[model samples]
Target: MMFLRYLAAVPLIVLSCAGVPFGYLTLSSYLFQRSLPGEPAEFDFVAGFVGNVTALAGFWPVPVAFLLFAGLWWRTAAWPRISLLPSVPTAFVGLVTGTGWAIALGVALPLVSWGLARLAARIVSRPISGDVRRSAVEVLIGLRGGGRLRVQSRRLLLDRLPPPRYRESPVGRVAIPFDRIGHVEAGVVDAPAQWRFGNTSELTITPGPALRVIGSGQEWLVPVDDVDAALRLVVERAQARAKPEPRPPLESARWASAKKLWDLGEAQLSQTGQRKVRHGGHHVLLVLSVLTVAMTGYSVFRVFTDGWGFLFGALFFGAISYGTGRAWVSAGATQKLAEENPCSPLADDPDPRHRPITGWSYQPVVLGQTSDL
Candidate 1:
């Protein structure tokens, strides 16, 4: 099934790209009465030779590049392994599939390399520095003494500076002490906007050194001078806070009955994600359609001239090329989704993390969590 889909998509993509120039040629031939084969036989011979040489050179490089990247990735893994020969077969298969296959493989290889690099980095990189120590304390709501203090999470390491402490009305259950903070600032620095939760109001927090913190399993940064002191204060306050009332578990049969309606909501969300992908494809198709019309118009004009037939042939090729380009893009997107969310034959499970790369589904990662802010 996958192979069949790929076959259908490849030609469409190739045709889409080839259409434009072919159309232009068609128009030119009709208007100027030019011939496609007016050149010497030697020109044909030379073109064929060049084409063959280019194809061979292009095909040969695929395995080499793939092996190089694979080796680089392996070195970064916990257990490095070499499989150059295995990769070579795949590269050869790509070569046999012609220019479209070669082009797609070329584009996909870099992306795959990037993914491997990221995975390797994650495996090899050290955890955040644990040297600094600070104290955290709970402060009264609307209190004046709490200078700006940063909120931080332990899990994140990037751009994490301490923030100044402030008193909010009915202040939250826990707060870290100002003295425990290593660094403090008045405003949010290069923090991922999602951390703000779409809140427009700026909050301030201060000791004046850099600090990192974790909240709800995610990492955040704040200015702090001492990590130990800040952590102590936070621990102390959290211990002192009043516990909330217990809620009923939703895993029971009664709740399960009500959950059926929520399943529909999930379905809606999935549909929306799919629609966004299709909408992007629709935009591309619309552009191609407009270009096709323009090309056809040019070809019609050329029909009155001596080279009309050649112009029409080129136009046909151009259309095929344009179609191929579109199909290729669509198929590539589908392939990415499929790879990310492999199907399981025995279970009817849908992966919740399989988000389409469009519309509101598109999100920025902060401390390893996707956030809207």
Candidate 2:
């Protein structure tokens, strides 16, 4: 069935290619020669003959011949299939350049024949206007409901729409429906919160009644019928916008401890008006430096010997190594941190009655990360 379909499609493809130029020429001649009442009889006869030839050529037999030959060749050959048939452009080139030169030059003809192929490709390819592209983007973004919806269609239905409109802002273009808004709080006198979207005023809305406003600026007040709805909406928006955040650099138990030490050193240096300071343990630095130098040397050797192929292989290997190393380091760091700070943030009391706890508990940590606390 598949083979039959493939065979059937070939005739249609050939006909389409042939018919388009035929129709175009026919229309152009009709438009230009319509005024010539006393045209030469030879011209009329030649035009009729060309039209008939074009109609016959656009029929199915020509493409069927190519398809049948291809199928027969493929079934008989053991090696990879190579298309023996010449395409329209190829045939045209062969006709113009003559069969002897084409056969001698072989496939090299295509590169020389690029000018003709490119001209055909250009005639088929049409440019889309800027307005069309912009309209497409607007429709896509507006439909998603995150960005402001632009009400471009100002018909009677739109005019009757309620005030406090939900539309994409001309600025940031994020979707913020007016009904979800709670209260609008303006920026303060001393320190004004930055307005990100546009030059438009910023407002922080408490999504619902109970949800805590973690970081505050100017809050836009949304009227929510239920607390759960507000929380769900905020969470949904945050999740949708959240791409994978960048991971921290250091890993390993020793490296984790070294980072704390480094942070302490940075604090001390900052107090003394120093611009830079080294913090991590000497052993961590030494290990990292040695690894870096070894990898760099290996990369240089591979490049000199095998060029691009070696470099590609090395890059693939390096990516896998880096990812594995990062995962190991992160896990080690997490375990070490848990060991150092035994008191879980979710613990009922500030101080536990028993000995300091270590290792994972059955309960998972929800809400934000330790940094948020």
Candidate 3:
């Protein structure tokens, strides 16, 4: 019951950034409709230009657009009518882009934003707007409920932060300097629940993935819709704050870890003077290879004396012989050991290109150190 209430009470702080342009335009249009503050006999032509140019609020759209576009701007509060964003663009068409282009842009922009918002919202598991690539997103801190995690350029703000315990404690927004963030990792939580975007609900959670951010001597687990992309955002931002050098992207990091594992295997093989890879079926391949080779040699002779059908048999046997031979040689199995325990990792196949790359067969045994094995 408590769990249901917390889930129901998921705090929604206004995460207006990408849609700021739309939101800003909404602000300008409202001013024209309601008349701008300090209106005189001569209407505020100067404010209109400044409002169109800046688009922040109250006729200051320029710096806000540039900063928001650059991913440098982040604000907690809705500028004006941001919550009513769907109606905002249409409402602002007359002032922001002029009456002629207002209706078209108002409708068109929202449609485009609706599509983008759908995609990004699905990723972050919450409603969002604008291009996420250059905008900020709000994330839930706990797997179920905690606080709003507002990702900014140089810092991360945890707003309306919940108390650690039921006992009374000092509750305030916690700001963790982005530069201090060291490790930004992706993981999952076992919270099977439905994500409600609007009236529609997309069922896409079982073991939903979340991001674990650790830095500045603190750690935060952020449950987002798109954990991988969000992880990349945190990684990129952390690197940007910490060093001139960049951290590897997700795929690259995976490959690097795999290579490290291979390297460890190679090091072990070097020290042990043998391959310990537990790959099997090499002994069977060896027998099949010998049988196929003998059969192919006989078929080749029969092809010359017999018919074209014999030629096909000879070619088939030859291909099988080659494949089996290559696999057998690479299988890391010894004849005696394979016969005793075919699956044993300790069994040595004469192929030095085995589990580890210490070699007589693969690489030249230039030195006597690895010559024994």
Candidate 4:
């Protein structure tokens, strides 16, 4: 199920694919059509390689996107025993996978890795049951940055910083966790200048420093104030891991009815998963899709100089890529959804502390043992 969840993250794959154009441009600008710094005879191999790497580092939209995707999988899936799997190797793997699989490799790699990680976990890693501390929080900010996060429940940083308000407005300053972000447009809650934190805003994320505010068993992408708030909110969420809140009889009846529907859906989903694993029709389709995306980057290279019609190439690429996403969801997702069915004792709980690995789910990590994981 955990594998299925990661497999479903094709959007992240597409985001990384955007690097295709950037890589093209960077290479063209730096190496291929470079303005040589000195006479050709003076060009040193070591200097050239280092400079190229630096230029590549400067254009990091693709790598950062892939890093997020890889980190999520590595921390939640591999971890501990697979300690060395993610950091350097994950980066290299992401780069390899992002090479215009635009459709093919993106889907295939997730499916393959998901299975491997699970199998490895069963062998090398022991489930730290009821343990929330080891959740994929590392995926959020600890990408390459190392330090254990000590969960301090109920700790707030409102006092550590200036009162969390700007003038009369509720200043919602999102410390986005990207290194080189551009063109930010944030909305104010009450009015302009009267901003609020945590509002959903479009982010143009690049590598350096991203302010990923994860907490309360939500996806790793939520914007929070500080780690203190993260600890407080996350711990508050999982602090109830040992017990559950009693729902009213009416709610329970409604939940029971929902459970019946969920069970039926689960059976159908399991069948579908089985069909995918058995028939494998999508494998061929995936190959075609990858070829299509590679063509997309090539077909309309001169978007800036070419007429507006070139934009259609990008649109076509997007539509085709979007269509290919369903094939990416692994069969394990069926089991994941089934496990989270109402029949499960922890189905309604958001505490990640209870799960060993983050089960099949979308991007991000919550602090603590969550049932939904």
Clash count, one per candidate? 83, 21, 9, 25
Q: Across residues 1-373, which tens digit of lDDT does each residue of candidate 4 receive?
A: 3344344444334422332233323333344223456644433555554554566553333443344345444343322222222223333545564444333433343344444444433322123222323332222212112212222221111111112221211121222111111111111111111111221111222222222332222212222224333433344334442232233343343344223322332223221111111222444444345545654665467576777787788778756755664453432233222212223333332343322122222223434433453
lDDT, candidate 1, 196-245, per-residue tens: 10001112322232233323212223334444444443433333332332
Write down the RMSD of all candidates, one decimal each: 23.0, 22.9, 28.5, 21.0
Candidate 4 regions with alpha-carbon error over 4 angstroms: 1-48, 51-237, 240-301, 308-312, 326-335, 342-373
Give lDDT per model, in order. 0.31, 0.30, 0.41, 0.33
Best-fitting candidate, scored by TM-score: 3
Model 1 Cα shift for residue 299 (angstroms):
2.4
Range of the 10 consecutive residues with the lowest summed lDDT in candidate 4: 179-188
TM-score of 2: 0.17
Q: How would you encode candidate 3's per-residue C-alpha lDDT over 152-183 as one tens digit per residue?
A: 54566555433212111111233445554545
Q: Pick the candidate with the highest lDDT.
A: 3
Q: Estimate the lDDT of model 4.
A: 0.33
**Pairs of colliding residues, candidate 3:** 54-61, 54-62, 55-61, 56-60, 56-61, 123-225, 123-226, 124-225, 125-225
TM-score between candidate 1 and the true structure: 0.19
**Residues 33-74, candidate 2, lDDT per residue (tens digit)?**
554577623336457548745655643323433343343322
For candidate 3, report its TM-score.
Answer: 0.29
